[model samples]
Target: MRTLPIFIILLGIITINSCSKDPETDSDDQTKMFTDNDVLEEIRNNTLFFYQGDTATLSAAGNSPHGTFKLLFNQTALDALGADGKLAAGDTFPTGSLVVKDVIRNGNTSFYAAMWKQPSAENANEDWLWYEAFLDGSLLVSIDAKGNGCIGCHRANTNRDFVNSFDLH
Candidate 1:
């Protein structure tokens, strides 16, 4: 019957759609596009929006991996902060938010640290995907890692969803 053929076609379409891969959930793809050298390139090209319009915010995090740095945020993160660039303690950035820390040393930059909010049941970084890498694309914390070393310090700002700059600054 013609109806039987139509049902088969619809089933095939549903199967294909259901099996399609979601780019956002793929760790490999996220690392390639967001956490790797492409991000360094973006920083070098000055395409990212600096947070709170601050060009160079001296890193309060002293004698550590991060030296002098500038904070940058995507539109989603900016919206979470509102026009005042302030959030009451415990406010968390929503999914799709991106935050970057451009680390500079002696007028030369060689590291780009970032966090992207992607909620998942296994996420341990407060639903954020942690990424910290050097300019050469070497990873300090791989995309698949849970970011334990990072979360340790970030816990100081636990109320701010593990982000320190906005709350401390």
Candidate 2:
């Protein structure tokens, strides 16, 4: 009788182990459901912003509406852009590349705009996903589906790989 209980416990352990998902694999899956809170937590924990040179200032009628912004690139994206000292006319950022624009209003960081480069196969039409979020506590806003708004403006800058801050670098 004791042997039977031991066997059942062993079987249960094996089943649980087999059903569990790999954390590393799950983290790398871009399609996974990442909530705004989750992304904000990651950005805060990872210290995603690093570059601190010049602040790109905007006028009242501009996109940021009288805000000063700074562009920050992840190491992977920085390597790709730095390889040529400047991003050429048709250079596409590799998958996992992340660009963040920190927007400042009244000497305080109010919000952020970000772009995440997805695998080309994921979105054949537009591989880059756009996001906006308030720094205080608002949820992330995904604007990729509204291509005509954000994507349309970026499309005009094909030379800089659909980025407006390339000149700032």
Candidate 3:
């Protein structure tokens, strides 16, 4: 089936990108995937929630390289969360959703970990474009490069669409 090849390609991308630290460059072709401006645009115009709006609680990392941080979801992601402010068990995020995690260090964002859901026949499952980078667009983990540990660490069942932020928090 077509799905099988897509899965293999995805696995390879994850494996390769995780092991490689390709700094995001202007010359890098991210047009078909995503760009830094897309992240900024989401932040500027969409809903942002931290600790699900419980400001007193800032979640600490569990086996995450990112220390203290907040999770922000764009309109698509927020809409997906629905009234409960949480995804029901077994429910998956819709296509075109974007969620960004701000890894705060010393009161400022040291880096970002983000997920973007793409259209696929799998109901948006396993279709996320994983990305992580520093403030100046230095890619820590790109959509491509070399073993993407990002997928392994960020399993979908965690009230996430490859989002590890909410479930553990």
Clashes of 1: 0
- Backbone clash pairs for candidate 3 read 14-147, 14-148, 15-146, 15-147, 15-148, 16-146, 16-147, 17-146
Give each model's whole-structure lDDT.
Answer: 0.70, 0.61, 0.65
Q: Residues 22-110, candidate 3, lDDT per residue (tens digit)? A: 54543343334545455445555666665365544255766776667777776777777756577656677887677777888878888
Per-residue CA lDDT of model 1 for 106-133, tens digit only, reads: 7777687887776652443567777788
**TM-score of each model, paired residue for residue:** 0.67, 0.61, 0.64
- lDDT for position 118 in model 2: 56
Over 4 Å off, model 2: 1-34, 47-66, 83-85, 120-125, 143-148
Quote model 2's TM-score: 0.61
- Backbone clash pairs for candidate 2 read none
Per-residue CA lDDT of model 2 for 1-169, tens digit only, reads 7799999999999987876766655645545343445445544655453454334554333343325766677766776775444566677788766777778788667787777665432332366656678986474565434333577667766777777665544
**Where is model 2 poorest over a 10-residue stretch in terms of lDDT?**
57-66
Locate the minimum summed-lDDT window of 10 residues in model 1. Answer: 31-40
Best-performing candidate as measured by lDDT: 1
